[model samples]
Target chain A: MNKKIKQNIAFFVFRLFSLLIVGVLISILGFIAINGIQVIDWEFLTTAPKEGMTEGGIFPAIVGTFYLVVGSLIFAVPLGVMSAIYTVEYAGNGRIVRFIRMMTNNLASIPSIVFGLFGMALFVNKLGFGDSIIAGSLTLGLLTLPIIIRTSEEALKAVPESYRTGSYALGAGKLQTIRKVILPSAMPNILTGIILSVGRVSGETAPILFTVAAYFLPSLPDSIFSQAMALPYHLYVLATSGTDVEASRPIAYGTALVLIMIVLFFNLLAAFLRQRLNKKLKQH
Target chain B: MIETKNINFYYGDFHAIKNISMKMEPNTVTAFIGPSGCGKSTFLRLFNRMNDLINNTRLEGECLIKSKNIYDKSIDVDELRKDVGMVFQKPNPFPKSIFENVAYGLKVNGVKDKKFIAQKVEESLMAAALWDEVKDKLHKSAFELSGGQQQRLCIARALAVAPSVLLMDEPASALDPISTSKIEELIHQLKSNYTIVIVTHNMQQAARVSDKTGFFMMGELVEYSDTKKMFLNPDKETTQNYITGRFG
Candidate 1:
């Protein structure tokens, strides 16, 4: 009715929406923790499924997910950081650089299911790796590549222009300037990008679904060629397609909780790393 | 010695530096005083080829240092820069220790002996008049120093490469009066070994530290002469007006 009332109403609406998001997040976490906490123990975390996906911990799946994450990071981190350095530093702001940026953004927007299918055709079938850890990792790496590149580019760009000029003024070449000054300055933000990619790569089910995920694996994957049970896919099978979905519901919830915890751990690690790097860069 | 013969520079389509000629003798301090956007800083940067870092910039005419045309295709830019060091308006030390900031030049130029680098760092800092303040904390971060100290650190960084020429682009504009005086004193002391060219907005600073003075306006060098002659009895009316603070 009046300006004060209108402003108050707008503030109330915005506050309500923000609180609603927190409420939804808490309810989801609360639901999973309450349902799965009783089932989780050292044995549940360390042993394989025992009775047709109805008992025992999702140990093989957890190990498989861990391996897949490490493999993807190995494949993606260097490639992504290098690509970002090229696009941001070497390429200059030209038509080709603009095109590369556009393509990266487009790649980020592409469906994860499309990546899964592509991985199946390329790494799994054409490359003849079949359903294996390598294929799955390569797929997940592709899925995370755009994220890493974009974030790394931002990190590199955030470095002050004065640093580049300062390095150049001291008779340093471009490569030397980048190596000695730019990279160290941008390292914190670049590491943040890598950690964020790790979080996203861990929870993704689609890209790894056709490439390496197994409906049931008796043991952990021994090599890159072996098919492995992954947490997201294991949870999917337990909740939706297992022989007794109701019987495996608690295990499915536990798997979801573990996946969430892994993501949370990485997020915390990113924050911790950023703080440490900022302090080190600012002080010693 | 540094000389520019009728040099003109363009930033894309805009003429940023009109035809200008000047000579700076070895071991003498020459100051360019001008209003903002007068291209004094741009003209100063030409000696080190620092302007080349900007995109779509064009230069015509010759820029020479020590009788050799630095603008020649045969000249290696990195080598040119090694001989012509530049200090910027803002003190830009890398995110590194005080010692490392000074040693950066030597490290990048492939100087490997740790003992030699350490020696050079101390000498450069001493020359910059910052060694006594930071000598106890060489390994400490450069950001911990005061702004004036940081500016001196930048000068130390520039001097560490053993350049024969030094370019100061308003090196004391961002500092307090005490720091400004310290930098000006440092400039005076440094003139015996390095040919220094400084661009200053502060006219008194130009008169105090320079052997020669050049007044620039609208991308043109309006007057160039001995500092005393230029300040007391300028040959041009515009120079007189600018020096006397009649107008920029």
Candidate 2:
């Protein structure tokens, strides 16, 4: 009886430790959901900001966020995919490959704020893109570069060497093997990486803040030179300094909740894609 | 036909294949009979320059395919590989449909017609003796097949390119007896069209399939002669001991 009691106590302690972290997260999410759901309205999502408040609706921010995701994908994908090819296909465990790998790992661990500062000096100031969507997106692209490279490298690495040998034995050159066999096999995982980058961008207010100065333009961007409002910055302002604290509270929570939902939708999408691709892969 | 002259290989100063010189005739199946780590597979890979992939690996002397030295700077590896096809120990099919697996080479070389690819895929499958089983499921993934079927698919994939020389590195080592025999029969049928060179540790397999045999031991060619002579009367005591149920 004593031994069983001791065992039960141990199990309870372990359960408590696990629940402590999970419980806190769940409670936070619940609080946000409860507080935010009422603010969700069609007008709030579609309408522009009113007066100087910048808290009325997130239309401009939504547009800006979309631009950010698209622009970053354009810049980061080819570079990441090419680097992954070099690392996984041609590179041995030599000094240069090891160095590139080390740099990639280091890049992933870097703080977003530092990237913001770098963007401020590099794109916003030096290159003269100013507080434009392009500047902010390039910063985000830099931020997501290492992630895509590492994830793609991992996906490429996960491909069996037998596949390459098979291709080569079939008389395929280097590019053909990578283009047809390796790239297609690694696609779903690469998509997951890009999706993860999108999630990373949607949550980033700090990187855009320093890089893209608040322009509050009501019109859509006609060129890369225009400054834009990001969803994260808009959410920050709505939560912090709105006209009616009680009324704006809902909008803040709603935006966050929407962001979370968007992220979750993408995550689930990635999971679905991974599942389907894995099934197809198993058939081969 | 391939002829190696005083060939040697090294992996970072460690000798892998030492002074291997042998001539393989057209339309003849040559079995490389050996124990493990005797550099049989290494020697086989030299014909298509497959060994050029290994880091810090250096080759000395020449490997000639039809009097053209494959190691010369003018030699296009892509073209060399097109002429010399290889099948590995383990069956490796691409993550593609059955038809695509066989038609990969043709597609890469820019054959765009749909009907031609289909015809070639069927012809290769028939040549590899797998058309009857997998004909209906041509659109299915290559990995959906069993190990034996996958190996045959690999063979079909190789044959689609119509290479003159085929190198098989322990082609039946991972297969069951029935599947192995099927492969042997397929090899026999293919001999008239392809110069088949195979490496195998199974003495019975080597004895059964090969017209000419080369027994290798410790990175050296011990004996090369008619399969019957090697089995019935070996030149070396070591060859006799290794082959006649004495030692490997």
Candidate 3:
């Protein structure tokens, strides 16, 4: 075949694959929306389950998932951002830095089921927290920690080198330079890391399965130590293991749609915040 | 006011600056002119120790400013930098407002009196010949200014710390001819208050702005003398060929 014909065929294949993924995503969303939209009244959203997990809304699971997301972020963001600053800024490319980077990469690739088991062994049983929000959050936090660290490191590194040199030339110390110049410049990008972690922590079922998820809870969690009904785990039980699986299928679809919406909400919030920060940096 | 004694610098195993000794008088404009990669900019950075930021770089010999060894173990590098300020090849204004850009040096040095900072910012801007252009929009972003104006803002930022020595590493090389002339004129006016050292690829720029001139070639200072004598009657044949546009 001629080069032009070969190039045309390659381009067509690439376009087909890209559109294929988009088609798959749209079909899944359409399936869930069509099957779930009828069950999504205000009463369905705000009330507890009725008739043995067959009727009513998954309010407690919604709140529980929300709590887990917030808790995980509270646990991971500070630790991850600080670690990234230390590794990317203060730590030169020495043996220790390389070792730390290697360990982080290894941690990122570990299966979420392993994190679930580790959390059960450490937070749930050994530490005696038992299947509670705190334990589950810590587990999910660990799962997302490597992602945050990698992203924050990239964000810090993305800042122009001239800013650091400019600050130092003005006689600013390392800490001051980072706090005043580097951190402000890297804030928008670091927020992207936080956004990504929120999405990951919210949708995860395995890590929370053995740590914090409840099979059936009618009320919202009263404290951090209380067993919580998370959306993903609740959906899993309703769709797969529950006695009234066919009856609760619509509720499970609704729960999946709500989870996706929550993730989308947080992503939109973060994108808005990034825009404001960039504008603030530019205007004043 | 500035002196180096047999300075030798290396980037790993590759020697960048050979043994070179020179003295610059206080309150005079001294220009170092050379081709690219001739170590003129590297030698200029030695005054402020900007090269310390790079890794695996080695320096041998004493760099003294005001008769104090800046490279001594006891010296505080930040403190030394405050006494010697440098402007870079490209204008690097922080992503901040015009007022904040000039106030950065003072704020970093722990000056908290808002009134004093405001006054110093004004004075520094005036000294850099930028106050007339940007006085009305102090709160606007520094990026809003033109390239020439931003370079002057950087100079104003350096002057806010009250350094006695100013170093310019090809400050006008990236600018247009009109802006270059403006920077050259600013350097002439700034000589009485600060010891100025500049590195330029333009030999005519050195002749026009420098009181003393140093010609560097392949990591060596081939000649150092009064600007008129170096350009009019160079001591070395190479310097003569270079100044007369014969050397490649």
Which ranking of candidates, highest lDDT first?
1, 3, 2
In model 2, which residue pairs have backbone atoms overlapping below 3 Å?
A284-B143
lDDT of 2 at B224: 96
Best by TM-score: 1
The order of the candidates by TM-score, greatest first, is 1, 3, 2
Worst 10 residues of 2 chain A by lDDT: A50-59
Task: Go through the candidates in order and give the C-alpha RMSD of each one to the true structure.
Answer: 1.2, 1.9, 1.8
The docking quality of candidate 2, as DockQ, is 0.68
lDDT of 3 at A162: 85
Estimate, for each residue in B72-176, the C-alpha lDDT of model 2 and write its tens digit.
999999888878999999999998999999999888877899999899999999999999999999989988888888899999999998899999999998998
- Per-residue alpha-carbon lDDT of candidate 1 for residues B14-81, written as tens digits (9 for 90 to 100): 99899998889999999999889999999999999999988999999998899999989899999888
Docking level for model 2? medium
Per-residue lDDT of candidate 1, residues A1-284 (tens digit): 99999999999999999999999999999999998888889999999998988998899998999899999999999999999999989999999999999999999999999999999999999999999999999999999999999999999999999999999999999999999999999999998888889898999999999999999989888899999999999999998999899999999989999999888888898889888998999997
Which 10 residues in a row give candidate 1 chain A its minimum summed lDDT? A262-271
After superposition, the stretches of candidate 3 with alpha carbons farther than 4 Å from their true spots are A1-15
What lDDT does candidate 3 reach at residue A97? 89
